[model samples]
Target: MASLNSRVKGAVMGASMTGGWLLADLLLPEPWGDVVLYAAMAVVNVGIGWRLGKFYDKQSDKETAADFDAKKAANYELPS
Candidate 1:
């Protein structure tokens, strides 16, 4: 479930970035426009990548912790 959500989030972010770049290119003028468009794309992509990276990292941590807990529970024994 977490994996699926992460993939969906990544896909949405990619699609939005592409759409935004295209729109910016169309609306803005010549060389300066291209420059701005690329810059904005870079910045946005970096920000989104950073944020999603953290989110996935946290999700992975949660999954690892859950797995560890399950294993610990399964192996638990009564002290004599």
Candidate 2:
């Protein structure tokens, strides 16, 4: 599992990269320019998707942990 700091850093990096690629695409000249930009966009999209997946996995793990804690608490019995 990644520490919270790593996850935050990854998300920030992904957002900035995606935004920069988009802005560059708008400013650059045509033909191969669009092609190159699209390629970069695709790469950034994949990175964003991967990052989102990681976040989902982390959320699931947290939910599972909370469920286990709840179960453990419910099953606690008084001493005989």
Top TM-score prediction, candidate number: 1
The numbered model that scores best in lDDT is 1
- Stretches of candidate 1 exceeding 4 Å from the true structure: 1-17, 78-80
RMSD of each: 4.5, 5.0
Worst 10 contiguous positions by lDDT, candidate 1? 1-10
| lDDT per residue (tens digit) for residues 27-80 in model 2 | 989988899888977886898789989999999999999999999987896668
User: For candidate 2, which ten residues in a row score worst on lDDT?
Assistant: 1-10
Candidate 2: misplaced stretches above 4 Å?
Answer: 1-19
Global fold similarity of model 1 (TM-score):
0.70
CA-lDDT, candidates in order = 0.86, 0.85
Error at 45, model 2, angstroms: 1.2
